[model samples]
Target chain A: MRKKILIVDDVDINRDLLRAILEEDYTVVEADNGKKALEIIYSMKEELAAVLLDLIMPEMDGFQVLEELNRRREIIGRVPVLIISGEASVEVENKCLELGISDFIGKPFNNMVVKKRVRNVVNFFDSKNLLEEKVAEQTAILREANITLKAQAEQLKKRNQEIIDLLGTVVEYRNLESGEHIQRVKGYTKILAECFMREYPEYSLTQDKINIIVSASALHDIGKITIPDSILQKPGKLTKDEYEYMKSHTTKGCELLDAIKSEWDEEYKKVSYEIIRHHHERYDGRGYPDGLSGEAIPIPAQLVSVADVYDALVNERCYKDAYSPDEAFKMITEGQCGVFSPKLMECFRKVRGDFEGLAAR
Target chain B: MNLKECYASIGADYESVFLRMGSDSVICKFLFRYFDRNEYNGLEKAICEKRWKDAFIYAHNMKGFALNMSLTRLAGASSVLCEALRNGQPEDGVSGMLADVKSAYVITEKAVGNLERE
Candidate 1:
C-alpha cells in the first residue's frame, strides 16, 4: 500500500509540481494554505506518513503549525514533517530544524533528494515507534511477574510459620498437657515482651522481635516430647534419676533444632533454640541444664521463662493442682518458681494484672 | 517557441527545472497554472494599500514559486521586494523593488504562455 503524504503550499503550481514528483510513489494529499493543511493534518493524522510543509502561507504558516505541534507533544514525535521552502538564510533553516522538522528541502528540490528524505524519515520513525511499543510491553510483563513472585514469597512465609505452630501443638498433646497452655504462654509472653520493650529501649525489643519471641515461647517445652510418657505423666514426685533425665529435654530440643538449621531462617531458629534450651536456665546461676547466670541468659528465653512459670502455676498438671491467679502472680513476684533478671522482674511486675487476666481466660 | 526556448527567454534554468519537476510536460502544466494564482496580484494590492505584512507574505510566495520553477529573474526581484517589506515596515526602495518584481513576473508570464500545454 502507498503511504500518504501531505503537501502544504499556497501556490497551486508549487503544490502541483511536488504532487507530480511524489504522487507516483505516494498517495499525495494537498492544501493550498496552512489553515486547510492543518485541518487535513489533524483529521487524517493516523493515516499520514509525512508532511511536506511550505514555510510561507496564508491564514497560518509552517512555523505556526510547528508551534501547535509542539503544544500537543503526542503528535510532534509521531508524523515526520519535512520543510519544503525557498528560505534564503541559514537562520530560517536552523530555526525550522530546531522546531523539529525531519529535514529541510530547499526549493527547486531534486526529485531524488525529496523521495529519499521522505522515505528515510518515514522508515526511521516507524522503527522508533515499534521499539517504544515493545519496551512498554516488556515492562508490563516484568511488573506482573514481580507481583507473582512477591505473592509466592508471602505464601511460603505463612506456611512455614503454620508448620512451626503445628509442631508445638503436637508436643503439647503428646505430653498430656492442655492445648490452652501453649496459647496462654504465647499471650503472657507478648504482654511481658511489650512491657519490657517500652521500659527498656536499650534491648531494642521491637514488635517484630516480640512476635518471634512470642511464637518461640510455645515451643519452650517442645523438648518434653523427647521424654517417655511414663515419666512425663507421672502422678508422684520425680526421683533424682528421672529429674536429671527430664532436665536433658532442654539440650535434646537444641539437637532437634540443629538438624533443621538450614530449613529455618536464622533469626527464628536462633530465638527458638534460645527459648527451648534456656527457658529452664536461672538468672541467679542456680536453675539447670546450662546454669547461665545473670544477664547471660538470652532475653528471649528470659521472657518465655517468666511466661512459662506463670502459665504452669495457674494451670493444673498431673502432679500439681492449679494455683489461684492472685497466688500465681504473688509467687512469681515473690520468686517462688525461679529467680529472673531484675529488669525482667520489673517488666513482669508492671504487667502482673495482664498475666492474671490471661490465666483466667 | 518550444518549452526550452520559452524557459531560456525568461532567463530560467531549463535543465534544473526539468530535473526538479521530473519532465517537460509536467513543467509545462504547472507553468500554465501560474496564471491562475493570485500571489502577484495580492502583492500588488497589499503594497498599494501599504499593508506591509500582507505584501511581504505575497512577495515571499512569489519568490518561492520562482525558485520552484527555476525562474531566476523573478526569484531575484521578488526576494529583494520581500526583504524590503520585511519587519512589517516598508523600506524606501520597496516601490522600486516591486516594479522590478512586476517586470520579472510579466516577462516570465509572457514567456511561459508561448509554450503549448501538450
Candidate 2:
C-alpha cells in the first residue's frame, strides 16, 4: 500500500507543485495553515507516514508547527518530517535541524534535483518501513509460539491431574465409596512411607521410589474388587468362609495384575504387583492372606495398609458408627507394636490433622 | 576427451557446474552431442549384455548429471537406477529408469529446445 504523505504549506502554488510531484507515488493530504496542519497531523496520526512542511506561513508559522510537533514528542518523533522553504538563512535552517526535521528542500529548486531528493528520501523510508514490517512479523510469530507453549503446558498439567483423579476414581469404584477416599489414603501413605524410608535408608527411598510408592498406594486394595459385594458391603461380622474369601482379595488382586504383566513395562509390574499382593500382610506373623512379617512387605503397601485401616475405622461406614479420632489413634497405637514401624507412626501423628480434614471433606 | 581434464582447465569451480547437472537434460544433451548417435545406444547395449560394472558406472554418472539440471523427477529415477546397479539390482529398477530418461529427453528436446531456438 502507498504511504500517506501530508503537505503543510500556506502558498497555493507551492502546495500544488509539491502535491503534483508526490501524488502519483503517494496518497497526498493537504493543510494550508499550520493550525490546520496540526489538527490534521493529530487526527490522522495513525494513517500519515510522513509530512512536508513549508517554513513561512501567516498565523501559525512553520516554527510554531515544529514547536507544537515537538510538544507532542511521542506522536511527532515517530513520523518523518521534511522542511521546504524559500528562506536560505543559516539561522532558520539551524533551528529546523535542531527541531529534528528529516530533510530540507531549498526554494527555486531544480525539478530533477527535487525529484531525486524526494525519491532518495522515500526509498530510505521504504527500506526502513520494510525492516520494521519484518520485525513485526517475527514478533508476531514468537508471540504465537509462546502462546502455543503455554497452552501445551496447561494441557499437560490438566492431564496429570486427570490421571490422579482417575486413579482415585478406580479405588472409589471398587469400594463403592463417594468422593476421593483413595486420594486421601494415597497422600497420607506417601508422607508416612517417606518418613519410614528415611529412618531406614537401606530400603533406598529415592525421589523416584517415593513417587512410585505414592502412585502404587492407590492400588493397595485393588483386590477388593474380586470379593463378592455381599461380603464387601456386609455391615456386620463375617463367617469364617466369608472372612477367608475376603482375605483372598489381596492374592487375587496380585494375580489379576500379574496376568497383564506382559503388556506393561517391568517397573510398573514390580510396584503394582507388590502393592496388591502385600498390602494386607501383617508386620507380625499373624496377618491374613500372607504370613509375611515386618520389613518384608513393600513399605508403600504397609504404609497404605495403616492409613486405610485408620480412615476406615474413623469414618462412618454402613456397618458401624464412626469412631472418634482419639479412639482410632488409640487402637492403632496400643494394639501391636510390630504391626507398623515406630518412625511411620510418628509421621502419621504429625499429619493427623490433614487426615482428619480429608475425612471431614 | 577426459571430462576431468576439461574441468581442470577452468579451475575447481567449473566442476560444480557438472556436479549440478547430474543426469539432467543439459548434460544429457552435452553427452548426446559428445558421443553422437552411436554412443548412447552402445552404452545401453552394454547394459543389456549384463556387463554390470560398466552399466553401474554409466548410471551413476547419469544420476549426477540428472540432479544438477533441476530435473528433479528425472534425477530421482536415475538415482534409483544408480542405486540398483550399485547394489547389483540393475534388472530391478532398469525399466522405470529408462522410461524416465525417455520422457526427459522428449521434454528437453521438444519443449526447452524449441523455446531456446525461438
Model 2, span B1-118: residue lDDT tens: 2344333432322344444333233443453442233223534765788876666655544444333333445456656665676655565658667667556544433333332210
Candidate closest to the true structure, highest TM-score: 1
lDDT of 2: 0.67
Model 2 Cα lDDT, one tens digit per residue, A206-252: 87777766776777777777787899889998899999998897898
**Per-residue lDDT of candidate 1, residues B1-118 (tens digit):** 9889998887888988887767787777777787656457888999999988889888887888788788999989998998888789888988889899989988888777677766
Give the candidate number with the greatest lDDT: 1
| Per-model TM-score on C-alpha atoms | 0.76, 0.44
Model 2 misplacement above 4 A: A1-4, A11-29, A42-49, A55-58, A61-79, A85-101, A104-114, A130-167, A176-180, A183-220, A223-309, A312-324, A327-351, A357-361, B1-118
Steric clash pairs (candidate 1): none
Q: For residues A141-170, write the lDDT of model 1, one tens digit per residue.
A: 999999999998778667657757876877
RMSD each, Å: 4.8, 29.6
